[model samples]
Target: MATQPREESANMGKSTWLAFAVHILTASGALWALLAMVAAADRDWPMMFAWLGVALVVDGVDGPLARAANVTEKLPTWSGAALDFVIDYATYVLLPAFAIATAGLMSSPYNLIASGLVVVSGALYFAYEGMKLPDNCFRGFPVTWNMLVFVIFAFPGLQAYSLAIIVVFVALTFAPVRFVHPVRVKRLRPLTLAVAIVWLGSAFVAASDGMQAQGLTGIGLAGSSIYLLVIGALFQLSDRMRARSAE
Candidate 1:
């Protein structure tokens, strides 16, 4: 019977290392994002967005893997959430900010201001305790500046429009609305995952090629964007309905 506790402790030791490996893999995605910025500086759009895509994949899988590994229970000393937030800020915010500023996505002066706004608002959003809702939605737009950067780069003629869009997203960072978390929101997980996959493929297509590719990608982006907006609205309405029922 006494040996049982030792066996459990040994098993936990192994599990903790597995959990830590997951965190390392996720954090490496941030380093990958930084390298993506180097590609951005070289004006190699394909490689830059490719690295971002890799980072997105890492971020997407790590959480599920960590949970399955029982990370928190195995390694109470390690704070996976803090590590995730740090990597998220780098991959989702800082690298995109760098790309926008250097890639001429917006007009000269406005690009700098827009990039700064993204960084500032993203930092605030990350620090906001209410960023994550009880229902697992983001309290506001989740600071997906990387996607915004990809969209802007994919559509060169929209330089003027990009500035306006950036401003709106920055504002939305502080807005009192919920944004659907594609993986976390359980209502339409399969549909959300499908749209996200399509959107990502479109993003790569749009980033790599010319007008024909851009045209198809644009349609995909528009469709996916509408789906996300509708999902967010559904989350809000559902939460309100639940609250009223409780009362």
Candidate 2:
């Protein structure tokens, strides 16, 4: 019986190490962002977006893996959530802000303002309490600057529109709508993941060769956006019903 406790302690030690490894991967995404910036400086949009995609993949998978390994239980001393948010802000907000500004995607004054807005608003959003809804969805737009920048980079003739989008999403950082978490949201998880996968692939292709099936990739991105809109609407409707029931 005493041996059982020892065995469990050994297992927990392994779990803690596993969690640390995952945290390292999450931090490495920021390193990848540095490489992306180098690519951006060189005007290699394809390679830059590719690095960002890698970071996105790392961010997406690490949460589930951390949970599976019982990170919090095993490593009570270290806060993985804090580590995650720090890295996420860099990869998602700061790096993309740099990319848009450096790539000359938007005109002078506007580009500078847009990039600054992304970094500033994103910082505020991270600091905001209740950023996550009660239902585990993201409250407001979750500051997906990387994805927004990718879309703008892929589609040409949208320099003006791209600036508008950056402005709009920055405003949306304070919006009340609940954005679905894709994998974490219980409702429509499979559909959400499928659409996200398709969108990621489409973004990759679009960024790699902006001229290859440009129209089709644009359509795919639009479809993905529509899916998120539908999900957000459904979440709002559900929340309203829950509120009415409580009343």
Candidate 3:
């Protein structure tokens, strides 16, 4: 009877470990999808954006899923942190830079100069702040905003305006602005979940339609962008308010 219980316990342990492995695999899969989307942007850039949107959705849930499965505690600290940073850099920085280059936005001499300046400035600012305030809040816009800019510009009708806006935002990313970081609250959890679902679903819808249909694409891109922008603003404001109260 003791042997039987021991065998069952062993099997349970194996199952738990397998569940953790699956979570890690899913996270890695999302990263690859993000990379693929950026690479595909050259030919059908909007389609790539759509895929990226889907990956973003997957990322939003992966953490919760891991926690629920009780696998988060089992992950090795170094391995997990390293993977997280890699995914973050790939999805936010490298991919957006690739998309900008592939879209030929930098072909014009003026645009080339502007793009180069924005990237260099952002890099220098990031390096300086990262080195100085290694543990504190970020000094500039997060690179994830680049994904938002890409999604906006990838749409057919919004293409022209989106390009202009993206250029401006690219500069802002390097600007000296202190964006707030809000705490996650229970009341806002539902709204956060809704945003993720809608944004990800819109991407799939846009991709299925080939992004050539201006009306549908416009709705999706605009809706997603507005949703994210509002959320970001709200989060920042809330964080600032909380900080003031604590002080």
What does candidate 3 score on TM?
A: 0.67
Using TM-score as the yardstick, the better of models 1 and 3 is 1
- Of candidate 2, the 10-residue stretch with the lowest lDDT total is 206-215
lDDT for model 3, on a 0 to 1 scale?
0.56
Among residues 3 or more apart in sequence or in different chains, the pairs in candidate 2 whose N, CA or C atoms overlap within 3 Å are none
Segments in model 3 whose C-alpha atoms lie over 4 Å from true places: 1-12, 30-42, 70-72, 109-140, 156-164, 167-187, 238-247
lDDT by residue (tens digit), candidate 2, 1-247:
8999999999878877898897787789878888988887888878887888899899889989888887788778888889888888988899889877878877788878989999999999999988987667888889888877777776666666888888888888898877888878878788899999988888877776742326778789868966865687577988799999999
Could you tell which candidate, 1 or 3, scores higher by lDDT?
1
Q: Give the alpha-carbon lDDT of every model.
A: 0.82, 0.82, 0.56
| lDDT for each residue of candidate 1 in 65-121, tens digit (9 for 90 to 100) | 999988888778888889889888888999888877877666788889988999999
Among residues 3 or more apart in sequence or in different chains, the pairs in candidate 3 whose N, CA or C atoms overlap within 3 Å are none
Q: Candidate 1: how many backbone clashes? A: 0
- Which parts of model 2 are misplaced by more than 4 Å? 1-6, 211-213, 241-247
Residue 82 in model 3: shift from native, Å? 1.4
Candidate 2 local lDDT, residue 178: 77
